[model samples]
Target: MNKDSTQTALLWIVAAGFFMQALDTTIVNTALPSIAHSLGVRPLVMQWAIVAYTLTMATLTPASGWLADRFGTRRVYFTAILIFVLGSVCCASSHTLGQLVIARVLQGIGGSMLLPIGRLAVLRSVSGEQYVSALAMISVAGQVGPIVGPTLGGWFVEAISWHWIFLINVPIGVVGLFAVHRYLPRATSTAAPRFDLTGCALLSLCMIAFSLAVDAPSQSHRAAWSTGLFALGLVSALAYVPYARSRRNPLFKLSLFREPNFSVGLIGNLVCRIGSSAVPFLVPLLLQLQLGYAPLQSGLMMLPAALSGTLAKRWIAPLIRRFGYDTFLLVNTLIVGGSIVAFALITPSTPAIVAIVVLIVFGAANSMQFAAMNSVTLKGLSHEDAGGGNSLFSMVQMLAMGLGVSISGTLVKLFSDQWGSAIFGFRMSFVCVGGITLVAALIFRQIKETPPAIASPAKPAVAGGR
Candidate 1:
């Protein structure tokens, strides 16, 4: 067979791993109400299951690149799969919210490595010319999982049971194990950097403390611990800046912030995501919680968003080519923010057709944002900086996903309590989320209008894996 086919196979395998990891994150968000009922917890208070996983992943992500660089990529990649499956089994069997949270931590520990290691494998295996295409392919797969996860999770809950949501991962894990064994290149760097344990500990503490503190009201009733954790988290995260300055190499790597485009892009992604990311979680909650929609109806309502996002990928490149990153992000950020505002207008009496159209537009615009921001962030990096920069970027993405939800939930709770109306709470939340997006558009405005820098031009097709 030819090189392109072999490389395509490898990319697909890597993308499969990514899809599994991302799918788990979003799938559980929608199924939380069902799972909470089974586990005997309040649906409003189940964010910890989500936060624990995301926080653990954020803490562990910095170390993944180092692990893959030291150990072979295939070794670490397979290890992640094994750990994730074990975590899933534990999660499926949990009888209490606490047990599920612990299990999710284990799952996050494993999930932290999946995308970075898989992407590392692809980067090391392919020629420089193929890096953008390879990454684009993987990004597309990663994107699809997030889109379908909610609807699929709801379907599973409605059709079978919540436990099956995790059980399904078993077969996919088995498949990934074999794919990695057969097709993955086992590679390691010769000059491995020393592991920075101190930095790692500080960052881990930062993530864990902040995450638990934020989710504390919803988790256990430990108000004191929540305050203490939030304090510790701030200190832990802040301490790293100076430590990174003093040391030769720090775990989180401060050098990445030096690039203006990257800095702004990362912030925009995190803040804007506060609006976009919470919707998937909140939409399902709204359906089951206030509207009393059945799981099946909720899932069906969700289909328009996911599918339209997938379809919208076709237009992203041309949009980027036409408007450039600055204009594209600015105009589209407003579009995204406005679509979210439209959700505030939703009432029980709102037509299903109107809701579906709104969701489709929101999902498409959100997908465009993902493709644009992600591409813009990494597009300028040199080969030497790509490894560390991308790893940090990924960490920020996960961290913000967790934090955004935490912050939004907190805001919603505060507003809901004051107004004494759940619908008012949701309305304010949507407006607040849109306001954040509008603010993010200003960040992208800082970027000069230039074509995004891709690694290398694509070559004519040839046969065999490089």
Candidate 2:
């Protein structure tokens, strides 16, 4: 095969890896209740199963580039697939929530590497002119995963079992392992810089502590310990900034923040995503808990969000081109926030048709929000700058996911307590999570202007991949 054909094959392989990672992460959200019942735990606490994986992703993402630079993407990528497959096996066999959380951590150790290393492989192999096309191609998997995940997981739980949800990953990961080994290239290290073990350890501790604190139960007797852990997390996280700024070969280079767009984009991506990301978590509960829907039905309700999100990605660039980045982000953020608040109005009496319509709009807007923000944030990054920026952005994305889930779980708990009714429980949760999105709209005010379109030569597929 020609070089271009070989590279395209690599892109597809890496994209599949990313899709599996994202699908496995989201597919479980709807399956949580079933898993909870089987394991005999409160469904609310099952968020840790997800929290552990995302927290590990946030912690390990910083080391991705450094590892690739040290060992070679080919080796690291294979190891990641192996570890993920092992984790999946363990997850399928898990007997308890505690065991499940540990399995997620093991799953995380494998998953945390997929996107960055795969993207790095693409970044090294592709031309600068095609970077946008490559990124857009890979990001399409992320969007599609959500659309398919819940439905697929639900089907598995219904026709087979929840264990099948994890068992499913094994075959996909197996194919990925073989494909990556054959297609991935070894990066020739010119004089290697020393890896910063100290900084990596410190950051890992900070991320772990912070994520645990976020996931901690609000009314649990362990609340005080959660507070202390969060405080320690903050101190360690803060300590990394100056220490990174001082070192030549720091694990995370603080200097990446020097570019205004990259800096604002990363932060803005995290904040904007918190509210939007939490919706997938909140909506299923509102359906299953409040509306008394079955696991299969609740999971099916997520279809519109996925479908509309896929469809809406096509219009994002044109909309941004017309309104400019600042204007598009501001307005879209409001729409996404308003849509979240709108969920508070959903009830059993609202009529199933009306409810589906509302969710479709919400999914479309949220999908647009993701596509718009990702393109805007990445629009200005240079080729050399892409590695660290991409790594940082990926880390922040996963971090926000954990935080968003934590916040959603906490709000539901807090609201349920305040109102003493499950109906009001979800109602209050909707308002708070929606309000968080509205508050984040202020962050975009910092963006100064938009850049000229650096259009790709090859057209990437739209959100739904059609």
Candidate 3:
């Protein structure tokens, strides 16, 4: 193939991998109830499956860059696909919830590396001038994945079986494996710096412990265990502070937090996302389990949110330009949080049109929120610190996602048990998560307004904002 052809092929290969990863993220939410039925578990309790995958990704994502550089990108990318495909097969064959959760962990291991490694490959292969455009094309694939994921997952569950949602990845992975081997460049390996294994382990443990603590309520006889895990997570997080401070080359520098916007943005991203992230997981359950909608109908209901989010991207730059980051994020965070709270009003008798309008509003606000949040969080980092800051930011994004689902599931179970009504439980969960988001708006208030010229370049709307 010619040079252009190679680059084009490489782009498609990476885009396909990104699509597969992004697809699996949202697709499984729609299929959760079906899978729960097959596994003889409650749909709400099945969040461990989601939590395991996301938390595993969060745990491993920090290491992907080092792994790619240490090993060749093509080799690591190929292995990632293989592991992901193998994990997908395991997921399809799971006979129990335990088995499914284990498989998801395996899948998360691979899913975690797909995008980061693929992006690294693109960065090494493409020229500086084309880098942004190349990433833009690949990001389009990521965006399209979530747009179709829920609906496709629902269609598969209704039309065939839930397993097909995972089975679909097999063929894509098989083709990708060959294409990656053939098309991806084998960049010369450089001696990578010694990885901060201790720091990474400590941070990963903190995230795992915290996530498990949030998830503990869903499991029977785990109150004591939950308290212990929360304590462990806290200790581990605190331990990292002194450890990183002492280390010559920590996994992430403590100095990164000194950037006022970075600190504010990062915390706001985690807190605000906790509420918004729960929406995707909770909405499908609301439609199918409560409203008596079919799987396909529930999935189709998500289209308004997805489409509106896409349309809202264009407005982010201009809005940030006009109002600046502080005001944009402040106002938009409330809109996003308010939209989530509005979901509490969506009972069976609620008009479908009203629900659709809410989804549209939530989608637009949430999209702008992500674009603005990401830009502000990243804009303050110096060129030297940008790479580490981004990696840390990405890790937090995944952690927040897992934390959101874990908290939402726990809240649902708690409220339902207390009130003896699933609908009320769902309503309370929405209100609580929305309240959590509302609180984050105060964090965004810390951001100092910058002139339009000084604002960071807008990032493409990240799929699911992670």
Candidate 4:
């Protein structure tokens, strides 16, 4: 294959990895009830399956880049697919919630690596000119998974069984394993840096503690455990600063923060995502629980946002080129946050057209924000810092989603109990989450007028037997 064709083929393979990971993320959400019924557990109690997957992913994300460097990207990426497929089979064969949760943890181990490593590969594979569009294209494919996942999961449960939700992964994963080996170039370091075991443990503890703390409110009514865990997470995070400073080689170099755009962009990404991420979890519940829509219908309602997001990728490059990242992100952040607030107005009496428009606007703005933030964050890093920086960014992204869900769920519960109305609880949750998103604009404002220049090219790769 020619260079252009080789690049295209590589991207599609990476997208397949993304699709498998993204599909699993949302697909299981819709099937939870059916799976619970089969396993003889309350649907509410099955949340562990989701939590275990996300928490495990967040905990293990810091290690992906190191593993890819120590091994080779092709070998690691292919192995990730194999592990994810095996976990899916385990999930399908499970007869208890405990077993499913364990299987989900196994899946998370692989799922965590898919996007970050695939992205690192793309960053290494493409030129500066192709970078934005390449990432956007990959984002488009990843977006497609969420678009189809819920609707497909619901249909499978109704027409077949919840087991099909996982079984569907087997065929796609089988294809991916071969495609990865065929198309992806080898990426490995001759002298990989020594693993930062101490820093890794500390960071992992911090993520786990924080995630479990926030998630506790949703799973149980106890405040003491939640508060304690939150404190422990905070301390663990603070502890990392000192360890990183004293250590010769830290998991993530503190000097990464010296890059202005990266620091501001990273903070903006985390805070903004925490607020916006809740929409996926909240919107479907609002549709089914309050609006009395069926699971399939609720899933279908997500289409407008997903489709708009897919189309919105094309708009990002021009906007950033014209307005610049600092200005574009600052203005667009509000739009994203405001759109979240707009959901509060969505009721059964609300016009379908109005609700769809809200979703589309939110989706478009959110997609742009993500593409821009990711570029700005990674663009500033030195080539040597790339692996650690990418891992940290990925960790924050996963943890933010978990935080978003936990915060939204807690708020809804609080307001629902206070008002004795479920709809009112949802409205309040939207407002609160949106407000938190809006605050992220202040963080984005700290970005400088110009983006930092890329300092070096990523390591070389071979495609089409180059």
lDDT of candidate 4 over 1-466, digit per residue (tens): 6778878988898888888888888887767666878999854456567778877888887787778888878888888999999999999999999999899999999988887678777877888888767766776567678879988987888788889999999999999998888778766664678889899888888888887776554345567889888899889989999999999999889988888877887788889998878888788778767787766777777788877887886788888878888788889999999999999999999987898899999988987788777777777777787666767777787778777877787788778878899899999999999999999999988877674332222421111000
Q: Write the per-residue lDDT of candidate 2 for residues 196-225, one digit (tens) a residue.
A: 888978877887787778665556667988
Lowest summed lDDT across 10 adjacent residues in model 3 is found at: 453-462
lDDT of candidates 1 onward, in order: 0.78, 0.79, 0.89, 0.80
| lDDT preference between candidates 1 and 3, better one | 3
- For model 3, residues 1-466, the per-residue Cα lDDT tens digits are 8889999999999999999999998999999999999999999988989999999898898889899888878899999999999999999999999999999999999999999899888888888888878988888888898899999999999999999999999999999999988988777567888999999999999999999888765455698899999999999999999999999989999999989988998899999989988999999999999999899898999989989999888898888778888888889999999999999999999999999999999988998888788888888788788878888888888999999998999999899988899999999999999999999999999987666533332332233344
Off by over 4 Å in 1: 1-9, 129-133, 186-191, 216-231, 452-466
TM-score of 2: 0.91
Candidate 1 residue lDDT tens string, 411-460: 67767778899888877888887788778998889875567432232210
TM-score, each model? 0.89, 0.91, 0.97, 0.86
Clashing pairs in 3: none
lDDT agreement of model 3 with the native: 0.89
TM-score-based ranking: 3, 2, 1, 4
Kindly provide the TM-score of model 1 when superposed on the true structure, using C-alpha atoms. Answer: 0.89
Higher-ranked by lDDT: 2 or 3: 3
All-Cα superposition RMSD per candidate? 4.3, 3.1, 1.7, 4.4
- Top candidate when judged by TM-score against the true structure: 3
